[model samples]
Target: MPPNTTSLIQPLDQGIIRTAKAHYRTQVMRKMLQAINDGTSIINYAKSIDILKALYMLKRAWFLVSPATIENCFRKAGFPVIDKTSNVNEMQMVLDVSEFGEAIQEEDFEAFVDCDKEAECFGNLTDDEICDSVKLNRQGMADLEEEDEEEAGISYESIPGVSHKDALMHLSMVRKYLEENFTEYNSYYDIEEMIEKNALINRTQSKITDFFK
Candidate 1:
């Protein structure tokens, strides 16, 4: 790549990367907000996120990027991309970061996303540093295995399960709230349909279990 031309020619730099970062930031913010609501410290909640969880979050963020966004990114990067009709509503990509209100300013959010832009990922490590890192990783894996074993000893029946009726009632409240507060937003119907489908599947499974009993 030529000097200073990467941004102009790279499809990711055009919009895809920014969109992914936005999605990821929104997810992080949601988690933080949930922590606050649950009376947990944000720092502690953030610290609880391990590499595996971060990978899962990144996977979800990438999956949320629409095909139309990709095509537009390529087109903006000087690529000859054909315009295709996408079922995905572009407005859905616009994140409601405003939910954080004064807690997170627009500039601070942008800074957080771009903070890693110039970060160096690959570097030569000293022999001592490599050995120390290996030891730390091994200890971390052992700790995780121990925790998993302890969790495995707990019976499934010991965990409380939500009833289908209660789940549907919660969804009803959500649907009602959205309908009243966000009259212009129509995607909540899709979410409601998806939840209802899951509830139906759960009810079918329960009936099967009863028949077996």
Candidate 2:
């Protein structure tokens, strides 16, 4: 009984496994890491989509997620996000922080994604309840079917400035902007070549737009 380190670690390890929600969190974090490694240059932005989508999915799927810890874990994993300064800034609570080194893998990123999706389409209700929720209208049925098709993939609709189509366009524009302005930012941007060739929105625009959005 001299310190009981094993006893302490056991609780920590057990807690992580016994809690269903925690398992989900770890899964979502891992998925986000994978998304970041896709070589988009603006990987921080991609990682942001991964985290926010996971958060939304967690709540939607009826598994309560800890926002503070979730934000902390993302930062620890090396993806930068500009989260809220205080509680008053509820809107800025969820942010993407990757402005540093290469991103790290989130432990449970995928589960959170699934949770959000299921919540959006099926919700916490029983099968009958979800079905009833859908049967209420023609549009609902169509939406439900469409959701099924999209649920298995990443959720980008809920994220601002993250649409695949828009992101591609932005990358092109950002690259052109960089070519015109590369000499201006050589000293400041670590990835000047990437900035000149991949980023769509400028830093000011990316930060400001995301801040307000």
Candidate 3:
């Protein structure tokens, strides 16, 4: 695989990755709104999310990626669909820019949908601006590292938004369902452990690799 050939050959680049990102973003917004509605300070939830809860939400989004969509992506990438097309209705991600006006105050969501002539003709960045951008990115990564440490230190009993008991119950249900349906998956792993180590949810490994084998 060449450096930039993924966009041309990867099925996930066709739409599956975009779908997952959109769903994840939507879930984040929904959780933010729910916290606000519950009169809890959204800052706490936004700042330090429970790692297990975050993984569970991401898994939900991953499962929302339909078999048909996956097959369609494979076909678009010049492969055959492994199984028959899924009859299940696909998830329609509808984002109303107007609805998000208050949620994101900086710019309208539609503004980012397309790059205008003005955007394309923007002058090159100054040396100072480039340095600032690099610094900002470094700071962002540092912040993420700090957050990861915080999440690692906390246990189920200390989670903020949802109770530990509820989180445990949800995980129990998910484990039972997966065990019944996916008998080959032979691990009664903790949700916290999975998220911490980035086990089955690693996105760097492409499904396309399996197709070629």
TM-score of each: 0.57, 0.21, 0.44
Best by lDDT: 1
Please report, as a residue range, the 10-residue window in candidate 3 with the lowest summed lDDT.
Answer: 113-122
**Measured by C-alpha RMSD in angstroms, how accurate is candidate 2?**
19.6
Best by TM-score: 1
Query: Best to worst by TM-score, what's the order?
Result: 1, 3, 2
How many collisions between residues are there in candidate 1?
A: 0
lDDT of 2 by residue, 176-199 (tens): 787787766453344444555554
The lowest-lDDT stretch of 10 consecutive residues in candidate 2 is: 91-100
In the range 1-213, model 3's lDDT, one tens digit per residue, is 444465668877666766665556667767777788888787887765767778987898787777777776667778866665653224233334344547763244323322241333335689999999999999997897778668798654566775555666787888888878886644557564655355445445669778899
Stretches > 4 Å off in candidate 1 = 1-9, 48-60, 63-68, 83-99, 120-139, 148-166, 184-192, 195-213
Mark the regions of model 3 whose C-alpha exceeds 4 Å error after superposition.
82-213
Q: Which portions of model 2 miss their true places by more than 4 Å?
A: 1-18, 40-134, 137-141, 144-213
Please give, for residues 1-213, the per-residue lDDT of candidate 1 as tens digits: 444455888887777887898888778887988899999998899877878888888999999888888887777778885565643236235455688888888778878777788975456789999999999999998897678668788744578987767877887888788778885756767876777787777664346567777
Q: What 10-residue stretch in candidate 1 is worst by lDDT?
A: 86-95
Clashing pairs in 1: none
